[model samples]
Target: MAKPIARKTSRGADRMETTLNNKVLTEIWGADQGVGLRVKQAALVVLGIAILAVAAKIKVPMWPVPITMGTFAVLSIGAAYGARLGLVTILGYMIVGAIGFDVFAGSSAEKFGLTYMMGGTGGYLVGYVLATFALGLLARRGWDRSFVWMALAMLIGNVLIYVPGLIWLGQLYGWDQPILQWGLTPFLIGDALKLVLAAVILPAVWSFVGKART
Candidate 1:
């Protein structure tokens, strides 16, 4: 009986290690072989939803405009959770916002829920999912392990976000309207700052984890 139990434990650890081969940052802490993937994902999704809400609501004062952490949170979560889990987490957060949770940066009690979702920010919301997916894919390819690759990945993700976002703005408003000014230009500086921050943070974390292991 003892030998069988030992073998089972070793097998489980082996399975977990195999699964974690292309691990994201979140798996670096609190992951256990005895725990199932579904359980870990469910918990991470919940925590991610909460983090999205808080990041959406908070604003840091900056020179051009107040910096909202919403996009940063979305990208980071995608990089940390990978593609499928990131999709689920972002979708869950969107659903919560759609149901009138005040989970969006521009939403208010007076104008919240699905109506708000269908407004100007609608395209950007769609972009969030696309960008998240792209980031997840890049992170899986080890882009998040180095500052240069991470920065490039972030630039690609931002482009994914802005493309649909600008198109949506054009369709919603008018083609002649200053869609660039309204939706893209003002945000570029802030996005650049965020890109640098993410580039520095993700690689530094990987370095820390590597050192700690040795």
Candidate 2:
């Protein structure tokens, strides 16, 4: 009697997606799954706001200019948290600042709140939202998983931040003023270093996660 041949199923037939599409660090961690959707989102937003606050004050000693980790936090959180959550987190941070919380690097008790936000850093704040969205979007495409792609994503994110920042400085001060010197040139070294750091960190984190998963 001839036995019927058995068929071999495809590899990982029941496994989750192996590719990095639509999956971010937060989703992989599944921390939000422990609570309701709104609750998880709210908690993440609060956590993000706190992170931004702390990052705003952290200064790494470097050449030419000290590197503030605020922008780095903004970009990293956006990539890790995804677009919608990142946007809400940034808005929440802004609201906290607007209500006079001294949550900005350049703001103080005497000069905090809306008055401070509407000053020099206002345009950069707007850029924060845009750059967050851009980073989130790029992360969705798996750019955060590789050194080259993550570096490119960070570069794009920085550009998104700087363009509006420079424009705001020009409009706030004047075109004849040294807008480039005041807002762009001096910070290039710090930004470049941060960019390299981010490029290294994100990919390394992903690699660590990959190894842990196996």
Candidate 3:
């Protein structure tokens, strides 16, 4: 899994985790699945989900959609945690939201079931799962620490989200809605900015971790 390396400032719990994470970095990444986690591991998974949920609340209303730190949060978390944990964390968040916990962008799942999947933003939500997985791949390669790589990764992640989003939007709004009018017209600049933000943050995280190791 790829993610922004949270700066581990202390030497007890934080250092221990940092060290262990470093050691298992390869193993967690090498397998089709991630490295196995026991009880302690499960706890970390839940914690990651919580982190994303908290970030969601600190959002603004941006154009083309509700502006939120949710995507940035997920990308960073996925880059930090790797695929298995990243995926589990997001799914956990989704599961909680579906039960009507206000964890998603819009709050309320509207009955919360298969019906939600057929809704307007469902495809984008599904895309979150994918974006994180890809971020994990990059994180494993140690590109999580590289700015350029992170930018590219974030762009790809957004594209992955958008592809399904556009298709679903067309299905819902009809192809006559004018592609430029609803597809990417309002969000292109913002998407670029988000990509830049991810690039800056991911490398800073890598730098922080590298410095810590030293």
Leading candidate by lDDT: 1
lDDT of 2 by residue, 77-99 (tens): 99988888888899999999999
TM-score of each: 0.87, 0.90, 0.74
Instruction: Give candidate 2 regions above 4 Å deviation.
Output: 1-10, 31-35
- Candidate 1 positional error at 143, Å: 0.3
Task: Give the higher-lDDT candidate: 1 or 2.
Answer: 1
Q: Look at candidate 1 and give me any clashing residue pairs.
A: none
Clashes of 2: 0
Instruction: Residues 135-173, candidate 3: write the lDDT tens digits.
Output: 887777666667888888888888877788788788888
Candidate 2, RMSD to the unseen true structure: 3.6
lDDT of 3 at 209: 51
**Per-residue C-alpha lDDT of model 1 across residues 1-214, encoded as one tens digit per residue:** 9999999988977776566458888777774456575688789999999999999998988767887989899998899888888999999999999999999999998988999899999999999999998898888878998999999998988898899889999999999999999998888888899999999999898888765653
Candidate 3 C-alpha RMSD relative to the actual structure: 8.8
**lDDT (0-100) at residue 133 of candidate 2?**
88
